[model samples]
Target: MYVAVKGGEKAIDNAHAWLAEERRGDTDVDELSIAQIREQLSLAVNRVMAEGSLYDPDLAALAIKQARGDLIEAIFLIRAYRTTLPRFGYSNPVDTGTMRCDRRISATFKDAPGGQVLGPTFDYTHRLLDFKLAADGDAPHAPVAAPRQEDTPHITEFLKGEDIIQDEVFSDDTPGDLTREPMAFPSNRPLRLQSLTRGDEGFVLGMAYSTQRGYARNHAFVGELRIGKVSVEMDIPELGFAIDIGEVELTECETVNQFQGSKTEPPQFTRGYGLVFGQSERKSIAMALVDRALRWEELGEDNLGAPAQDEEFVLSHADNIQATGFLEHIKLPHYVDFLSELELVRKLRREAEARMAPKEAAE
Candidate 1:
């Protein structure tokens, strides 16, 4: 840990005040409200919530506003705020099977049980600027569709029905929480998945992309990608029953990977699962790919020595908050260390010149 020594409290205080005023942009323009940011900048808020590991949109929005749209800074703010919150007992695991899906699609099949519901997405849109937004004009009203009354079953359930895909194994043991306990090496799948879900989006995305480019490549097909709300429940000890505490929107991705069986088992398609707090499909998909890559040992695959496959490597560097602190700390004053190094270099140069002087006289 690096400690930076400093003085000038008045200067620091003045700088902070100026920074706050600067965040207001111009005095002539109207200030942005938290509600406006929560609604208008929904994607940014979602990203902050996902990375911050906090599910509160309002708090995420406030962080974004305070950080002046710097997402990493916003996530840092939310994380700092999260520590003060009171802890309640953990809620029961959410069941994605009963999700009221806003969007659902399966890449493996041309047409699946739940036909693709294309919600608000930029996937198909051409890269073009909307000059209309410049004129302060409202967007055209989006065509409203009737919400489906029935809960949509996961697309993987059909693949599982035929007994083709490998079954997802589960244990009754409670998984470790990284927030509460320090992360240990040789992390279990539960802990790894937990890290990936809350990991930095860019870092995880790059690691996931590496796998696609043949670094421990595991050919994965998006068996199903669904985004919707799932209810969070908590059991009551008094009645041996559970009550619905609340619901949270989530993106769940299940990747089907073709595997050539090892000596211990027969060849069967395996699954990689990714679940996160919000509609973060990119992160979810990346999490799935990296999740699959990291499962090399369990699947009896060779250790390809890839970054994604390294448990400690990925988990250690995945946290943006931690990474930012270490990286940004270097920018703080290190004048004492620099001066010592500078003197050492000068001494070495003088010694080299002294040795060269004798050689020159002899020549």
Candidate 2:
């Protein structure tokens, strides 16, 4: 009766079959199409795009369906799919100044030039359950208006006019992608922002909240938050020109933080910047807060031993995919390591017991 189990291959096959069946769900009912997920579960699709660093809604939707609606799994699918695709070239830095914004608001000011358009938000909705949505439900239609062609000016840029906000020195430097290249220490703004954007929303939120709770308490005022679509262009090196590849939705947040002026510098306000791949305002805002906290050194502020101020700590552990994969991988076979430890403990116990027996007999 001491026979060892030997169904690893069969077990794996059965698991796969079960997963496929679960994903499909209810053979009598129509299979949930990728289009259905994309249109119906758009917020989930957005989360996948934001975290996955890919903007294909359809593919994200398919990933959601295949993942049994697990948002993180959907993001992983998109990320894996994205890694296999060929890259042509980099696009010019997106001018948020000239962005065609669908939604834009500034917290620093009561009113701004571009004007606040509340566009598509669940902010004001009560948490009461809408019972109708328990099943497939029809949504109400809203009046559509022609898209505005006028260029949108950033709220931060307006503050720059009054010297109220620090004007970021723009450079033609092309920052290295963290995904393509291994993340190196002393990361630049672009790399830091990139990591924060794809970072887990809840983790970032907690870290940001920590700053407000007396940890690296840099008084932060939300300068602006914008959600909109922007064209992504890739340069064709062979053709010597850039072509419009596609467009993506982005959430951008800029936070105004207190800055103590240096010897040669004037007393001016500092900024924390955040930008993400989709309409993820919460992530963007959290990212901005944490971004400012991480800049304590550059701003010549004392490190208050805050977790948010520790760049090595925060940036290293920010990615959920990396964290989850490493943490969960330990669930697999480690019997060999366990056996070694077990043997050591048993040997040590026997040696200690044998040594004590002679002393006890003498006593």
TM-score of each: 0.95, 0.91
Instruction: For residues 118-225, write the lDDT of model 1, one tens digit per residue.
Output: 777778888799787789758678788676788887887788888888888766789899999989998899999999999999999999999999988989999889
Name the lDDT of candidate 1: 0.90
Candidate 2 stretches with Cα past 4 Å from truth are 1-7, 135-137, 144-149, 262-265, 355-363
Output the TM-score of candidate 1.
Answer: 0.95
Worst 10 residues of 1 by lDDT: 1-10
Clashing pairs in 1: none
lDDT of each: 0.90, 0.84
lDDT of 2 by residue, 109-189 (tens): 777877877888887899889898777757889778776779878877777889866788878887879989988898866
What's model 2's overall lDDT? 0.84
